[model samples]
Target: MAQLLKMENITKKFGEVTALNKISIELEAGEILSLCGENGSGKSTLMKVLCGIYPYGTYSGDIYFSNEKLTANHIKDTEDKGIAIIHQELALVKTMSVLENMFLGNEITQSVITDDNEMYLRCQTLLKQVQLDVDPHTIVGELGLGQQQLVEIAKALSKQVRLLILDEPTASLTEKETGILLNLIKDLKAHNIACIYISHKLNEVKAISDKICVIRDGEHIGTRRAEGMSEDDIITMMVGREITSLYPHEPHEIKGEVLRAENITAWHPVNTHIKRVDNASFSLHQGEILGIAGLVGSGRTELAQCLFGSYQGKSAGNIFMHGNPVKIKNCAQAIENKIVMVPEDRKKHGIIPIMGVGKNITLASLRQYCFSKQVINEPLEETIIHQSIAKLKVKTSSPELAIGRLSGGNQQKAILAKCLLLEPQVLILDEPTRGIDVGAKYEIYKLINQLAQEGMAIIVISSELPEVLGISDRVLVMHQGKIKADLINNNLTQEQVMEAALKE
Candidate 1:
């Protein structure tokens, strides 16, 4: 195999902070290289440099493509050199057709007249190459997340890409969808196209990559053959220490019921007739962790939303606090009733991106920091923000930094800090560790245990059965908006939870 690309002495800095050190890497045709690191470990930064998102003059790096000196001033320049990147957030316009998105910018033009027929034919071929059996004219918004991901890949293929960069591609994909994507990458490899795969999932990394490169804090740790590294080894390299256990579960006493939902039913936001959550009844006890386990769209999230009073659609249920029924028609009402939730989509619902981390942490409890109707106690607010950040161990250079600039794990921690500021009796976490790294996951799990120990009733919702089983004192399995089973998590297995979820 010929050398496809080389990045030598890559170094990037922001202000006085060095984001990427003198890091270097190489890739050959048809080879798959997986970049392993904790969140904010410079994987995305390196890719941005390669794709010219940082541009040539901004970063000190020598890129060689096809044995030629490659200096791209922008993404378009890199795309012309057969380089493409698929971001974690799918870039396709949801309302447009697959064919339109495929040839969005690089359309096949016939004398400046739009050639839909030619684009349609090429789009079909590209979809075929990716083994996606979807019509080119199909609306992208109508497709599932997995299918949308494939469309993004098919769109990349249409660009005649020789090298592809996938960033957290499977973060939002289902298990089956992820399998299809992994197989698709292998198929791409067979076509002699090189790939740079970046993900927090070590299992997938080991299964797919020809070699694995680990980086930490802007420095290259090492690059080794994927077959030679275990998940633990990769983790150790990435975090600079061996994580013997992924779940740091601690003993916490379970007490009497703190919150209960009886006959809960939630309607779809748009389709009023469609019930997203149906007659879901459950109880959460103080000093106990309750895990909701279900497949995507199984209504676990809807149930949490209903509990938090954030469900967009109408919901009917009897929520009791200490056996007294309480009315919670809105998020403010829920918060006032001592029930708060850390939302599933952190970026969308949890944090204010442009706001400072301190401001985001204090956003929910700002009233407590106000001295009067016209004034805010800035010193008091600052003190509380610092305390919350420290308590959550939210890694940030300063509380004034924009929360969006932080890593996924740090952002999640900041959100947790925000929720903790409210001092709610019953706390709900939806997909709390979805996109975080293993090290960060352990910390979150530990924090959950601590919260439970402090006599806080907690409800956790997760798609990963291992996570649900690992942390929950009790597990509730839901299927198609219905609670199928409530089982104690004593020596529970994934098979048992999955079986309950699929059971009629």
Candidate 2:
């Protein structure tokens, strides 16, 4: 029960903005401390300061590890001291094998020769510790997101880490995968390996942490024993306000059918014989929010991609707008027909990372701001960009800031703004609230309801059944590339949806 790590008076700044303000934290051996906050809050910043990603002198903080003053100038320095960080985005090289990624920088060597056999044996042992039953020779890219996550942990174990830092580890994982990860952390705890767990999933935090720390903006709110803190208490401390409802539902009239699909089928891009989406058909009505519920690999996302014309695979379907059949061969054609989607993987497909927030928001509808000879009206474009930022409530210091620098929640909102610029008749959102905190999720749900109220035909695909039940007027349960049931959301329960999805 000795103190393993302590960070005191941590303060970091970017030019003029103070990212962390006199924050302090302490963790003991075998303890799990959950860091809770909204997007852009100082949780990650504080961790970065601790792990030496921000470097020693760049931030004013005193770190004590093993009751000794620790001033680490690089991430390597911390890694050498038994501290390892696994970011939300996995840092594995996809083209490489699992063993290669595990021993990427620090390979076992003997007499100026790389010791592959020694490393392979160690890799197998680490994988066994994490319960990831994959071959060491398997390509990291070929593994599922859940398994890849476990690989990251196994890699950390190979580093001989004593204090581990995990950032949004379950953001992209399935429910079963998340369960496995939670259990693995408990196992690690039993072995006296301390951990700092950062996630927006309050239920997981409540279930896992020994202590909970809340940070707001750049300052420390407080840290308390996890035993007595409810998710509501954590929310109040993090957002500095009371959130009465997690899902804000407003009554809105559902109008006539605006779009319909018939015999929609999609084939896997690489394995052409496999059907990613099979003969899925549904109708979307104006001012109605439709929710698609399914587990991972159930083909919900493939169906949305097929509708948006962004599916990489071969697809066949009849898409009708206002009862008239239309052809959407590509994303451009889909956009031209006034149907747009905010994709599931925001970091990959949603926004241009290197581009400014303004440019990314206007990228989808730049034609509207162009004049003769494709010359853009800078004044008009800037005006609309500012307006979109305001409308979406995107928290950026300036629109010219790179969209990549924004937090996950703000990045998501910016992407939503970008899609809205197209002024689509039908909007499809896939996993819209993934990796974002509860407060930001509430804002997103409110916006979705508002859009539905404004007579837009909306489709929402989500892994969380509670989210599907909370906002949708109707729910479509898909299992094994088929839409099993379509039911009106009249006081529907999660059990009902799961039963439908699992029905034979």
Candidate 3:
């Protein structure tokens, strides 16, 4: 295989912080290179540099495409060279139709005029190639996260991209959708289109990659054939140490019920008849982690919101704190009752982008740590924030940094630390480790174990079957706003959970 692109001596810095440290990388024609690294380890930075987001003077590097030194002045320059990037978050206008999104900037024309028919036909064929069954005329926004993702890929493909850059593409996708995307990636390779697969999902990386390159602390660790590398070896290279086991579990025996929900049902703010959450009833016990496993659009998130009193409009639910039933109408009421929740979509709900780390960490618990009769104690607040950051092992230069500036894993840790600050009797974590790296995931599990050991009831909702089975004392599989299976999860496997999840 001939070399397609090479980035030599890439070094990037932001003020006093160095993002990339003279990292060099090479890509071959039709190759699928998996870029493995921790969050903030410069995987995304290098990809951005390749795509010209950093521009010429912003960094020191030399890029060669097809043996010709390439100039990456802007995104258009990169795209002009048959390179396209599909980001971690899908960028598509929801109001527009699939065909429109596919040929957004580069539209089709016939007889020197814009041709909608030709573009529509091409969009249909592309959708078929991607195996997405949605109609080309359908609105992109109305589609689920998984479907929207397929549309994003279709849009990128329409650009005639040769080297496709995918960043955490499966972060929001379900098992079935992830499989579809993985297959699409394989199809791209067959078409002689090389791909740069960047993700925190080691399992998917091992499954789809032809070769893997390890990057740690902004430096190139090395590259090896995917077949020859073990997950342990890759993890060690990325984090600079061996992480033998990913899941860190603690034995917790439930002593008493900490939270109880009965006949919980909620409707959409506009669509009342649309049952977002059905008559769901569940319980969380002290010193136990109860995991909720379900696919996207299965009402798992809605249920968590309803319980947290974050749901708008009429929500009929009987929430009990330690067997004592109480009514929750807002976030304040829920917090007062010692019930706290971290939402599923961190970008959409969890972290405030403009808010500083210390402020976001203390957002939930501000009421409790008040000093001098309702006036917030700045000194005490600082002390708490520092303690939380250290206790969580959050990798940040200072607590004053914006929460958005941190890596996905570190942002998640900040959110977890916020929940801990609330000191809730029950913790509702929805997709707690979603889009985060493996090392961060183990830390989250450790945090959960520590909380449970101290008699805190933890309810975890996740799409990963192995994660649910590994962390929870009992697994509650939800399907279509209803509990499908409530298993003890002792000696349970991913196959068993999937069997139960798919069970009618």
Candidate 4:
């Protein structure tokens, strides 16, 4: 294998924001390089520069490929050079068939017309190379998140991509799915196709990457070989400091059952046999953190959705608050019942990107400050917004700022504040500290500890095994839409829980 791509002294700026500052990296043939950074820390800008989205002269950089200095004038020119980026948001069209999505914009056609059969056959061959086991004709939207991820890999495989870039490839995948994806990456490297994987999941980086590059505040810290480094060491390198503790899970003695899910079952929107959730029942205690661990499609997110009344229709479940049952049909009813859920897909369900921080924070709690005529009160809304911003430690210019303008960590904090506005007895955080920096993660952990200390029954569903192990009093492992094992903290290890998660 040879040095396939080299980026030298990459410097990019967007108005007042310097997205990248003198960043440099290399991607060798048949090896994976992982870029580690917080959300706003220059990784995307560097990638854009390479892929020609930033173009030449827009950024101060030189991209060399195949031993030639190249100027990528546009996205097409970059693709023509055999470089492809699989975005954090998987760029698969949901309603389209797998083959259609794979062949989109570059469909296989006969000398006379479009040849879909040829396309299907090609898609099948490519999908198998990536170890996907679904029909090429299957609609991508019908598949689970993990399956959709496989489809994304297949789509990338359609082209002769020499340097494939993937961002947060396993953010929504289960542990099993993540394993499969990592294997696929290894396979790609075996073919001498270099890869650049960007993620905040340090464990995955340690497992798959040959070298790890740390970027902070839009500057390259350094790149180190991944062969010898502890998780703490990587965290220190990425954040340029030692975090004595990743999570301050100070045990708060449980008082009583504050929230309970009794006989919960959520059906799939189309297929019925594979119930998204199957007879799932769990209880959250006051002043304690409950962790739900599962493979992808184990119904963790579905169960949270069902509890929050965000499920499609006819969810068979009963939620009890302080031992009294309640029916929550929608988000409003769930808020009325003092049950708040921070969804796993934060960008899709949790935060409003275009809305201001103040408005988004006060979105779910306007009833508490309604005027005499039942209209939302402006002064009261401002007061609540400021209080939430301060309480959550959200750093921004002001509450009037757009939520997207903040870092991923601060935006997560904003969502935490929004949930707190309802004074929820039970707080459901689904992958809450994802895609953020370690310092931000510790701050969030401290906040969760404080919430637990305040007697708030908290249910945390995360894909990171270490995080779940660190924070939970009790861990529930789910497989195939059922709770496989509910184990106490003292009785669990990463291996044991992973074994339970892989149960047949």
The models' CA-based lDDT, in order, is 0.93, 0.94, 0.87, 0.86
On a 0 to 1 TM-score scale, where does candidate 2 land against the true structure? 0.98
Q: Please write out the lDDT profile of model 2 over residues 1-504, one tens digit for every residue.
A: 999999999999999999999999999999999999998888888988998899999988799999989899999999999999999989999999999999999999999899989989999999999999989999999999999999999989888899999999999999999999999999999999999999999999999999999999999999999999998899999888998888899888899999999999999999999998899999999999999999899999999988889999899989999999989989999998899999999999998899999999999888899885479989999999999999999999899999999988999999999999999999999999999998889999999999999999999999999899999999999999999999999999999999999989
Q: For model 2, where is the 10-residue window of minimal lDDT?
A: 365-374
Kindly list the per-residue Cα lDDT of model 4 for residues 1-504, writing each as its tens digit.
688988899988878878788888887898899998766777887888899888888988788998888898898788888889988778888998888899888888789689988887899899889888889988899998888888877777788888899988887676778899899899899899899999888888999999998898889998889897777877887777888889786768789988889889988887765688889888888888999998667888889989889988457978898899988889888888888999877888888998999898988777778876578889888888888888888988888899978878999999999888888988999998887777789899999898999899889998787889888889999988898898999847999997987867
Which residue pairs in candidate 2 have backbone atoms (N, alpha carbon, C) closer than 3 angstroms, thus clashing? none
RMSD, each candidate, Å?
A: 1.4, 1.3, 2.2, 2.8
**Model 3 C-alpha lDDT per residue in residues 8-65, reported as the tens digit of each score:** 9999999988989989888988999999988878899999999998897799879998
The TM-scores, one per candidate, come to: 0.97, 0.98, 0.94, 0.90
Where's the lowest-lDDT run of ten residues in candidate 3? 244-253
**Top-scoring candidate (lDDT):** 2
TM-score of candidate 1 to 2 decimals:
0.97
Evaluate residue 92 in candidate 1 and report its C-alpha lDDT on the 0 to 100 scale: 93
TM-score-wise, the better of 2 and 4 is 2
